[model samples]
Target chain A: MRNNDGNLVFERTPYISGYASVVGKKEGEGPLRDYYDRIIHDSYAGKDTFEQAESELMNTAVRVALNKGEFTQHDIDLACCGDLLNQCVASSFAMRSYAIPYAGVYGACSTMALSMILSATAIESGAAKRAVCAASSHYCTAERQYRFPLEYGSQRPPTAQWTVTGSGACILEKAGDSHNLLNHHTELKSNIPPSSGDDPLLKENHRESQTPYLHSARLGRIIDFQITDQNNMGAAMAPAVVKIGIKNNGIKHGIKP
Target chain B: MRNNDGNLVFERTPYISGYASVVGKKEGEGPLRDYYDRIIHDSYAGKDTFEQAESELMNTAVRVALNKGEFTQHDIDLACCGDLLNQCVASSFAMRSYAIPYAGVYGACSTMALSMILSATAIESGAAKRAVCAASSHYCTAERQYRFPLEYGSQRPPTAQWTVTGSGACILEKAGDSHNLLNHHTELKSNIPPSSGDDPLLKENHRESQTPYLHSARLGRIIDFQITDQNNMGAAMAPAVVKIGIKNNGIKHGIKP
Candidate 1:
């Protein structure tokens, strides 16, 4: 993590507080606890559409950033955020509160990661000083907008993860220690050879294995970063990740269960 | 324009079409021209907000891109667009119609330029081959949400530009050489003086000047791409054409105005 001193850089790990969520529009004792004291619940409840709710959520994130950072509107150099909306209305509406120079970005659920990436780039490029990167997924909101609604009772597979109706926001400060954004690394594992020598040359092996012989002939490829399944994100992404990682690392066998 | 055969590179020039505006509850005819056949009427009429209109307009743009580019639902690599809203609702909602992979972007009114920049980057990075970059602004919608009602008729300074309530979308294809995104040379003129020219005589001369002058005695500084008076982007952008023409071995700036 390199701080550009004048702009926001990425942070691998930083102190996090004020997490909030609007899943199912939960009213009490839920993910929105962090927002209970500061935010007005009715502010979001009165809206008729998901778009309105998204805008409200983004504004809430900005308010949180301002409060947690102990900085006023003037101190912020840029507001960077985006989501899966038609024209990035959530971000644009949120920016209305303050006149901070801004840039909106998108990358699906990967938006958070992409924001961090661009925040790092902008900081490294010295175009900004302090930046905020945030994203949200409103279940009731996203569902009605993206797929079938909750009322539709659409059957989903166990492999699929629930779409989280929540928002996450973080601030990247330029004056922090060097390890803000994690460095990009490229490395991979080697293929493991079959344990048995010459495949035993047995008549049973000659039969081409009537039984599916468990071959531990390959090592699973791994990425360096701490990998946590982002629930549905994992399954939706597993195929692509496995394909790339296995090929790049020279992993000889198929993906492990 | 160099075509790498479906490989996304940079373009040389492209035409813009299908522009429309909806200021307040009234629709403007400027955008409903040869290119535009659809008009997005607000559902709630006066109650129709910027977030909603912007989404509708962007959706129209995507539809236009789909029809004009002869692309199917799956053919679009990504949807890249953004607006002046707080949370980017416009791009997100508009993206729901097409099941194409998408990435929202924002740079305010400069959003077209910004999205174009990212589209170029995405194409160049091999992350996408075909990308659609679009942006929209709703003056009445923005005013009601951000500032005050347009009926208030507040006096704005000459430097202030009335936000145009319109949307524009462009489909960037790795196709024919005739259709390319052009690059223009940027220049800036500032009323700042050179540091090296600061001297005792210059300082005395500066004090005697009618207009505010620095000790360096310079009229202005010429920068490569910092367009000042950007409050009027159309006017400020004029010089770029001349500069680009000269740089690209086209007609020179034969006579200065």
Candidate 2:
């Protein structure tokens, strides 16, 4: 999982069992579409005619988290998540379904980062052996609550940005010396999912580049506890790119290139 | 409003602009049922499809509060209410209809008492001039979330109580000087409304008495402060009747009458 930089790198352990995501798509649409549609339909328990979509999105995140592991609702010690909406509805209501002891968190755009940090701490401190951290946002839903809606067709300046239109959930287990095997009981050999016709890498790279500082803060380690340094920053490097590119080209022209 | 005992008392305030309530019925169900219904349905923005019976119950309580004129939302700078259900959907969602900013609170039976104490402190500290504290417990809804449904006919012990099926909203205003003309617009009307032809009081005895206390460590002649102490302890007391009842009844009667 590590790059050549000799720095610590993290990866999803292959031994972790059971991962499934419920998605809806018309054709050539992104996974976010399924999340967006569900927000309009149901939050949890498959009930319709409910108005708040925020609750549904969080439920989906939790559902995805639960399905990916052997742990059931009873096994969960705590659940945590955050959202961009003014009220922390996503995290609070999601816990309703699991009925596991939980706490709601608020960290705005930095929510995912906050949840991950807390989740790691919980596992490390033995407060919880397994913890789930999730975060979700819908551009249309959050905008309506926090700002103008897309239907408003408002103009945007260079400073204006779009909110991420997806939710993510992760399950963290305390790493131990003993190996735990992942079991797949199904024998029918379900299709290997055809490697998804679309490219996930492209989408992630495009989105991550938009908020490089957030990405780095989310993925990086501390140089010191007091301050964060976003090395190989994405969005932060956008402005200086052209100047660096031109300078490099000029140097190359004077040399071998 | 102040009683001869020098304690501030709150009358229920309904959503209706002006109306009185009949006892034994819901608050807004008197002459202004139509008006009150509109507010309830609109308050949650049709997000929660309350049963006709439930809607009627909510309206009745609002009607009672409105008719009493013992409180006004305008007089309230803060509000707190919640129930046994997850996420406190009833109280928090109901708040969107009103412009007053509020914090929804949760504590099984202690919700109302806790809100009153919190609200009183906000006003006494000069942080706010008025406040509202509300609580509602819907038996059917709460049963589904917290325990077996009525269909289960589950056996219960004497210590268990059915969740109350009513919502109550109260407004607390800072007392004004007798000559202060500004008091007229906010003063609680003296007329008391009847509670008939409205939603039945699920249980009339559910209304517990609350005694307001202002604990001050220093000599400040504030309403709830005692003069004997030398510390400025700025806090209000909403009676812990249930807590006190247990001790007082046991000590005085040695058993229940």
Per-model interface RMSD values are 13.0, 19.5
Instruction: Give candidate 2 misplaced runs (Cα > 4 Å).
Output: A1-28, A31-51, A150-160, A177-257, B1-257
Best by lDDT: 1
lDDT of 1 by residue, B206-256 (tens): 233321211100001111244454345556545533443233223322434
Report the lDDT tens digits of candidate 1 across residue range A1-257. 22121111122222222233332334334655655433334434457776677777777766776676566655554456777664465666656566554567755666775565454333332333455677766666666556566678987666755565556666654322213222221010122122221234321332332222111111111122333443345665565355433553334334453
The CAPRI class of candidate 2 is incorrect
lDDT of 2 by residue, A94-155 (tens): 55556443434443455665565444433332344456677766656655655566579865
**DockQ of candidate model 1:** 0.10
Give per-residue CA lDDT, model 2, range B1-257, as digits (tens). 11111122222222112222212133235565554323232322233433223334434554455445454444344444544444455564455444444444444455565455444433432334455556666656656555666669976665555454556655544433112213332242233232211212311211211212222111001122233321111122222232233333334436453
CA lDDT of each prediction against the hidden true structure: 0.48, 0.41
